[model samples]
Target chain A: MDQAELAAKFRNKDIKAFERIYSDYSDSLFGVIFGIVRDREIAEEVLQDVFFKAWDKAETYSAEKGRLFTWLLNISRNSAIDKTRSKGFKNKNKNSDSSFYVDILETRDKTEIDIDVNYIRSMLGRLKERCVKLIELLYFKGFTQKEVSEELDIPLGTVKTNNRNCISELRKLIQT
Target chain B: MNVEEYIASGILELYVAGVLSEEENRDVHAMILKHPEVREEIEQIEKAIVRHTAALAPGTVPSFEFIKTHTAGKQVPVRSLQSKKTYSWITYTGWAATIVLASGMFFMYYRINNLQQDIKRAGDQNIQLEQQISDVRKDAEATEELIEILRQKDIVTITLGGQAIAPESFARVFWNKKDEIAYVDVSGLPEPPEGKVYQVWSLKLDPLTPTSMGILDQYDSDNNKIFALANPNQSQAFGITLEPEGGSATPTMDQLYALGVVSAS
Candidate 1:
């Protein structure tokens, strides 16, 4: 079975299941939260809180509802947004700028990660500006199709097909 | 459903993002399960998003031990102080004249409370026994009334033979067409598997439509193993199938234990 399928069958109180899920999805989840919170320590704290919520509410998670990643993403986005609004996080970073995920990647120069920064940057350069904004708004910011349509001033119908094409391109890039 | 067209619609990406309405999400989820191509497409979209985000992860996660301890430790109940107290009242205390007097008074109070509780408990038990006797008598009267109803001249007896799945198990159905009631006897059938009960179906075999005629509950406790059910349909056949607890919407053909057809009356 795939990692998504395995992560859905968590034993609520089992530390082994919690450990396995943490190891599997924590990096992606941390990245998503970190993308929003933009602070390592605050993002990490939010990430921990997200998993604790997941562990406590394991019975509510089911494969039939949505993918395990989707479930965790929802939790991470809500928690990080809530953190950003809090007094502590507001004091640290007040400016919520217009930089998308692509901007975030361009600034980070970590070699230890499997991501070949220059190669991905060159490939992502081909992905349109609108595609990055759509992903950032939809995935990172948790905007609905209606909200995205209003934000981008594009027809709602185009938002869907454009995302499909952009993700397909990203899939090919990542697979290679 | 056109798999290619559906996959190209791009709702699966939104689905992976978890932004769709619950109803919309369920529709996409059902599509993923129904079509292998849809599931593959959804997995690919999710992988792309996960990988893209994971590439930008800030730093290494702390050791799993921190999370493990936090999650595991929080559920543990605090050891209440009451749990630690030793109730060994027989232990010796300081031997003083005042201590002896105090002990005598404490013993007298304990004995009075204990005797009073014992008397009250005995009275409660006697009342419970009397109530049980009355309940049994009521049950006997109900059974006698049922027997009388079954013995009426209008009652039509139908013997249901065991199906291939359970050849040893069979049941009898007594129907009163005028009253629109069917009395089912399941004494011959063995106990149903755990979490399963025998559901009776009133069927019309021309187009093969089945209507539920209630379930045969209390299979173990009934002395005669007979249950009365409402059968408002002009049933051509009677069937019993083992179903999950609370019964199923339709009869499970493989688990059909007994089936019998009504006479052409």
Candidate 2:
């Protein structure tokens, strides 16, 4: 089924539709959560929470707001951010090394699962450090353009154009 | 609105990021309906982001059954009631007493199980609370130390005002010139983007030479956003520039975030 049809069915509390949505989007959602939380166990818990929240709040979702995947992505990101802010999470990770999602990708254990790690690595490798950071903060970290500009110490006016250029670079890499 | 220009404006990227305001989102939504190319662009952005993020997923995901059970819809079972059959008063009383006795035992068992679970949950909660208390205490102690450093009598304070690029941004350098150490208060600066660090430069104005003091590598993790770096330069001024991670040998002029000259002390 198309995303719209699946979303509509999922909204109607159709179990099959929910299962299909979970199968299709759960991995990406989990990846986004894992990127933020950086712990497998915590990421799993947050992943479950994201889906449960989505299930409970399905009716509030509409295509007018955004795509179904984007809706789920927002939930996952918010939940993961909340997890990181929790006192328990803070205490546990106080001494942990600060690493971004790229680090996670680079250091992934290859024995367990099959993914095109080399493809990802090569695709990401083509972008400059600035582009990588921009993509990470804007797409993965959900930072606003102002925040991205402030974070990168780039001109506020140039953030949108810079990001557009970066994503364009990414598009070329993906296409090739 | 020109469709091509709107597409090139990067509003679609912001839309995918889910950071646009509701009005902007509605506008984009309207545009998507009106233009197939716009929808295609959004779809491609969404696809690229999804694939990129999905690559970072851990080796395993939660079991499907777990989600199924948790998100299962509530359903009320239907039951048909049959016509009541007349029974002797003594038989009905006996049956009622037996049922009451059985229910009493079952309730007691269920209560004990629930209480046990509650006790376990409370114990876990107490441990988490204790951890939180310790973390907060540590944070307070760190903040106190930072305040002490900021208040030192020998510290020479310089306010690094934001440049034309970031008018709202600012930072402070509390340098103990005698000790050759500078404490940077970077709270005013926004958190550094990934793969980027705010590199402080001890500058000489006459010669326009820049010496890298140190990179604020732990900018995000540093709760106070205050970092202490060794400054061995016979510096006339201080400047901070956002450099790529690991820092640049020389500050990128355009990326210079804040700058301030030392008072003739």
Candidate 3:
């Protein structure tokens, strides 16, 4: 079934729908959550929280508000950010980067020689550094444009435009 | 206002990020509903971002079983309280206990008619509860270890900013040079696409040479995005680039998602 139909069933509180949604999006959602928290255990914890939150707030979601993926992404990002800001997280990774997502990706690329690191390298090759950073802040790190502007030291007006340019390059690569 | 220009404005990126103001959100929402191509573009963008970020995540993630345990635990009290209470407590306290016991025996016998149904439900719930407990234990142990890794005083943490490939994608590396280990936290990355996985490398700057450390082969299996790999080489800096299904010999500079210089402690 299409995601909209499945989401409709989920809103009706169908356990089957919930399970299907989990099956379809859990890994992808976990991917998103894991990107933020940097801790597997905490990411899993936040993943559960995101799913539960999705279940509880299913009624609030609609096609008009955004895609179901977008909704879940928001939940995952918010939950992850909350986790990182928590005292436990703060005390544990005192040196944790404001931009740790890039670190993990780069490190993994350097380590894993068996996967399609080449495809990613090529795909990433198609993109500019600004695009990587923009996509990271907006989608992965869930930073608002203002925050990204402040963090990256770009003008607020340019944040949106720069990210747009970056994502356009990304879409072109994905298409290829 | 043309579709291409509208898309290029990065409003869609902001839309996906939910960073736009409410009116802007509503406007974009309306456009997506009206234009199939626009919606399609948005999906493509979202997928690319998901892949880019997922690639940034480290190791095999924890399982769905872990997420379900605590959620189920929260529901049990409400269910149990609603179903079993009141009359039983009062009757058990008084001489009515004997009478109630006799009645309870009768009720037990009566309820035996539903025995098959009850047993099946209970058995399933029992397995689920056990799985939850196991998941919790596993999550706890992993968390404990991660905390220990970060606590090492000799570890140098370097933050790599997201390049043009994904501005929002950032990651941190805990370089325990003393132990020759680099703890990569890919928590900021999206998942790589199907049939693709992320590889790690230790780079020597003078000649711009790449050394393979290990691939983050456990991408989906790990709950946390933090991965540890051996890095015994003496390096001037670190860089990550995406390659084919297995990996590449040389760093793909464009696919280089992040880079950071090692600072002397």
Candidate 4:
């Protein structure tokens, strides 16, 4: 069902809506979280927390604000960032180096992509470096528009347009 | 606005990124609602992004079962649909049993409530009857005492005649000398006026001087108006007179209601 319909069902606490939502987005959400936190276990932990959070805060969701996927994505990013900045994380990873998405991408095993990883990898490379950075900063990193503009040193007005172009190019590249 | 410029404005990208302000988001949502093409473009953009994100995590497709397994209730929706076949029978039987039990319970409660009220009513009536029985027993005892006094050998029954002041009024005093007691049956006397009472006097008739015996107090409250007073005085005659309440020190001879002498017989 479409998001509006899905939202209505989810508001009623329909388990079916929850299941469909989990299946549709959990892996992608897991990738986004894992890309940020860089620990599989912690990523999985945040993934469950994100879903539970979505289930609990389901009533707060409104389509007028943004897409349902975007809502879930925002929650996942915030939760993962919180885990990374936690005291426990700070204590254990005091000497540990900061990891990026590119590093995780490189370490991702061949078997990780059962069949479709090659098409995706090629598309990932095909996306211009700026496009990848924009997507990473704005979507996966949950950066505000001002923060993205500052980090990319782009015009504040152009950030939205530029990100749109990057997504379009990325969409075309991954279309195969 | 042309769809190209609208699409190129990059709102859809931020829309997917979820970074747009609420007003901008709502405007875009309105646009999608107004224009099918806008909605289609938004959906296409969403699909491309969703597909790319899925590709980034290229792995075995997670089945619906894996998601369903961790869910709270694992019952298949189809199984519940199949169970609907027996729905009517199960519902009717359950409701039927409930109604029968409820009615039975209701009647039992009603009966218990009625029984309780009946018991209370019966208890009240029993108390009233018990009071009447006590009063009757008291009356019977008083009568028996009167009869026993009359049966005594030493009991002197004096017929006190009405004197010149009250010729129509008379009284009988049952004097039991051995017990030094006198039972005055004042039923023969007229009702005393308010604020006045009848006083009894014992007289030694040679000098005709009368001494106050006692006042008949609360003559109105006595059911039989029969009073018992101690007659310890050495006397020849008994007389009664009407006096004010709390009686005069000496008898009022003008209001003398009755007088009787102790004859030799």
Collision count of model 1: 0
Q: Per-residue lDDT tens digits of candidate 4, residues B1-265?
A: 5666688778787787777656677989888887788778877776776665555443443455644444554355664434335457889999999999999999999999999988866754554465456557767888887787778899788899988877888998888877888888889999999899999888898888888879997686566777888989877989899999999999888998988888765
DockQ metric for all predictions:
0.25, 0.24, 0.16, 0.17
In the predicted model 4, the residue pairs found to clash are: none
lDDT of residue B65 for candidate 4: 61
Q: Which DockQ value does candidate 1 get?
A: 0.25
What C-alpha root-mean-square deviation, in Å, does candidate 1 show against the real structure? 21.1
Compared with the true structure, what per-residue lDDT tens digits does model 3 show for residues A32-139?
776666556677778878888887777888777777777888888888888888887843434456445345555455544222355557765677777777776787
TM-scores of the candidates, chain A only = 0.83, 0.83, 0.78, 0.85
- Per-residue accuracy of model 4 over A142-175 as CA lDDT, tens digit each: 7867678678887565676677778778767756
Ordered by DockQ, highest first, the candidates read: 1, 2, 4, 3
Q: Please, what is the TM-score per model?
A: 0.54, 0.54, 0.51, 0.50
Model 1, position A58: C-alpha lDDT score: 83
- Model 1 score (lDDT): 0.80
Q: Deviation in angstroms for B136 in model 1?
A: 72
Residue pairs with backbone overlap in model 2: none
Better of 2 and 3 by lDDT: 2
Q: Quick one: best lDDT, which candidate?
A: 2
